[model samples]
Target chain A: MSQDQYFIAVDWGSTRLRAFLCKHSLNANIELVARNNGPGVTKVSDSFEKTLFDCIEPWTTEYGRLPIYLAGQIGSSIGWRETEYLPCPISPEQVASKCLIFEELGHEISILPGLSCLLPNQHYDLMRGEELQVLGWLNQRPENRKGQHLICLPGTHTKWVFVNNGQIIMFKTAMTGELYDILVNHSILIQNKTASFDQAAFDQGAKFTLQSEAGSFVHGLFSVRSKQLFSQITGQQSTSYLSGLLIGSDVRAAINANEWNVDSLDKIALIGAPHLSKSFARVLELEGYKTEICKLTQTTLAGFSSVFRATESSLITTS
Target chain B: MSQDQYFIAVDWGSTRLRAFLCKHSLNANIELVARNNGPGVTKVSDSFEKTLFDCIEPWTTEYGRLPIYLAGQIGSSIGWRETEYLPCPISPEQVASKCLIFEELGHEISILPGLSCLLPNQHYDLMRGEELQVLGWLNQRPENRKGQHLICLPGTHTKWVFVNNGQIIMFKTAMTGELYDILVNHSILIQNKTASFDQAAFDQGAKFTLQSEAGSFVHGLFSVRSKQLFSQITGQQSTSYLSGLLIGSDVRAAINANEWNVDSLDKIALIGAPHLSKSFARVLELEGYKTEICKLTQTTLAGFSSVFRATESSLITTS
Candidate 1:
């Protein structure tokens, strides 16, 4: 096996840290060797290095000092090392160029730069980890690199990226996931906090936003409370309803901000965990767009591997 | 004093309880004799009656078992007594007729019914205490009873009420205040949550929602964090910025749902405490509508007095 075949990708977000032991196989395609998760950036009690090594000690002992690429909030100000946010319109190479490379504890490390864009409305949108998923998605298929694509990465901060010819031109973030978290856990709108997924309730909530007077999000939020009050919807179904409402609002925001007519758009690529990505895909399809769902980890690994290929020799020599 | 002259008006919401001791003066206008505050419906560990009497024992002792009128969350299912919600278009008389009246501890207690409306979009909008503000605002001036009026009651659930010829034609509720509370207290968007108001930051936030694509509220919320990340806004200014963004969205929701042209609307009556009312009034005026701010205590008193006059004899007789 080539020395460059072995590497690791770490996704350290606010709540959890996922590390993938990956290797370029004889076929020259990346394959996962093992996977482990530890505390997130916020949850680490000891140093991040200690927490990371604890999770990957067995792999490191077996493989011997592999190059590691870290993404997400792990590269944020609160993370091990704060990386610069590269501005869009940017390609994977441009993002790789801005990586914060350093040597630590007999390991070569590259902290990926986050992405930022000043939207047309003079609003600044920033994303740390989702850029890797976008890059990976684009790298996964040749067709993805050739055309205009609107990619929706659904998470705590959902990023709607407008891509043209493999570069992210601009993107917007919606606080849909975060809002849902607080509302369900804190607000009076939801009484039954069951994690039960009710498809009909979800669709109904989505339709409520679709039919509501355009951008009546603040207004529609109250229905989560009033609908319960009037027995229009039960407490059991409220969580799903609230989810549908917010996701629908997010979809509407992207379409309205980008001025993308649903009928005219060819396809939207949704990148995230299966549940959230599928939810977004369902709503987008309802709005008259074709959608393809991509697993978050796969795309993220692809993105890191592609970038690793380009920047490997330089990072290794410096370390 | 004439037996009919003395009565008490109470506004009991989820957070606080306020009661006004009032009487009809020689001029036949209602005047407040004294005021007292107590635990809200939610904060009452003891019986609500005990909590009420604890605050107003002095007045009740001096006044000798006067008639009492109650409004707000105190009239909901979780309140002291669950009153029905009267559907719009409803007049104050219609509201009074639906009051839950009974004798309790030798006092004539009448719990007011809340108002509900099926909006044009088929969403059910409901309000408890704010109906009193709408009734009081219209009763305060003869002209208010004669034409179309938009009344905004800003609170945890802000109510946008449309009154036509002395009845509430329709209304909608926005979870702006509640959303603000959660975001400030729980979300990652705000860091420094000083309650200090920054006018410039507020205007910037308000204009952000205004200039962005109509209904881009979900998208705009993330800017509260990203703007800070980019140093476009500071931590201290975040609370005000968030307030402006949510209030601006609330206003936009009303405008879009009602399809009201900013230039065509004559005036919007903002009924709340001075601080919140003024903030809303300033935004409405900026949007080209003249605004009048009404004090909450005064409006609640006026609304109770109006309804009291209609139902006083029946309630007094029953007790």
Candidate 2:
């Protein structure tokens, strides 16, 4: 703990609100000081301020009036203040400028705007928190910014983004995680199965999906039940099989899109939870795409700090 | 209506236990006399006998130990009697011959065995109640025994069957309706919506799915939310879009399998609720396939009667 607390960073989404007390070290790195998670936007309802303040109470009190930068659903139409989405190819400057700035209880805070894009894939798409995380990830790798790169942020809504020359060109989302959650929890196929990870089952599911006769996701899904019927799959392994099936489908679609050269798309960075990232990493590798696993929180913090610094510099110049 | 009461046919399943008091018409028809639905096997738990008796008390008291023909989950491992599965290429006789026979309260009861098969698509498959319904449909049209027909029984689990000359050669199940239920009821995607049938939305969803980038069910699902985001699809239309996307995907996969000649597949039979049957009919029609819609309950009665008659004829010969 050589460095002191610098600022407060929050990644607030629909299900949960997480806050990180960070330190801007001498080497210009985001060192984590402390963390707190509270009810997310959906649960907080009218008590958004109460929940946000309740969790960051200790940190806020210690830092006095330090700046707080937030991202994700906190700026959604249902969040504390709704912010307009800046269309891609959006730079970090566009995001910072569009951030909704407001004050509460003698405190200064800004919520970043989300990104919307007209995908080349004949569909329109948008992402809230993950876009900022992508920005955070890009800010850390300036050397690799000159060329085109593909980044996948695996989550409830897995995003497949095309980044060209430091700007997000376009992105599309695949509802893999959310679908997996519903199928395992509410579906008759695997509702009785637990969420325990089984590597073999998962690998089998992914492999089956990849080799699936072209364009048959709905059919492959029903295999979960049939596999169980033929005693090829057990209840415990059903969940993993589902996970592999969904993740493998998601990856296969991206590969088929011809957006990424699987053989040459070296190091498609995975920025998400370690467990989820590893699952995605395995599936991508099996399909001949190299992957670099990165922590979600780190990238989110880096993104928040990057925008906060840009705003800070502008303020200094204006004064 | 001209026929007199003859036998009791029960379509016993996981969630609903339906008993039909049928009449053996002189014209070789099974006329409906009365019907009752009790707590399904899943809800009744181990007290299956109590629930069944409670619902059909009036009929049993009047008929005095009539023969009961049971099908579906009533004969599953969790049902009152665990019956064996008749392998595919099975005829009505095979199903009737393997019926789990027993006596209860001076009453003779027969539970028809389910169908299991290794699909031509290389997946193991099984069906309980739907197989019985298919048998009923086939029994009504003896002429259909000469050729192959594609039959779709749409419901919670939609079944696409390939029947050849009075035998069910093979079939595949798509979790379309069930997936639709969970998504509209539980998934964060569109959980707050009602099940109002939106004709336009459904048509749009089904059509959109038909044109979806090959092999990407997971990606297209996320578009339901994106379409809403882009204001191209409203909340009222979300359910239909989901329905269309799923049904379209299900139908497309079957068509692309190289197993069926879509242009010459001639008159695909649809057996299910009128509303859902029509939805599948519309989608299949849009893809240039002919669909013959039939009532599920009617087909179930015909199927049960066909088997019951076979058993009755054998009893007389044995005596």
| DockQ metric for all predictions | 0.80, 0.62
- The superposed Cα distance between candidate 1 and the true structure at residue A2, in angstroms, equals 2.2
Per-candidate TM-score against the hidden true structure:
0.96, 0.93
Task: Give lDDT tens digits, candidate 1, residues B143-213.
Answer: 99987888888988898888888988888888889999999999998878775999988888887876678
Each prediction's whole-model lDDT (CA):
0.85, 0.83
lDDT of 2 by residue, B1-319 (tens): 2245478888888888899998886667788999988777888855777777777789889877788889989988889989887788888777788888998877798988888888665677788888887888889887767688888899888888888889898887788888888888877668447757788888888877788677778888888888888888888788888888999998888787655665666788999989889988999899888899998888989998888778886886888
Model 2: lDDT of residue A131: 83
Which ten residues in a row are the worst by lDDT in model 1 chain B?
B256-265
Error of 1 at A50 (Å): 1.6
Tens-digit lDDT track for model 1 on A1-319? 3644888899889899999999876554889889999998999999988998899999999988998899999999999999988889998778887888888899988899999887766777889988998889878888888868888999888988888888988888888999999999999988889759999889989989977776699988999888888888888999999999999999877777753444556888899879999999888878887898888788888988778876864556678
Q: How many residue pairs clash in each candidate?
A: 0, 4
Candidate 1 segments whose C-alpha is farther than 4 A from its true place: A1-4, A259-263, A313-319, B1-4, B259-263, B313-319
lDDT of 2: 0.83
Model 2 residue runs over 4 Å out of place are A1-5, A25-27, A45-47, A191-195, A258-264, A316-319, B1-5, B25-27
- Candidate 1, after superposition: displacement of residue B304 in Å? 1.1
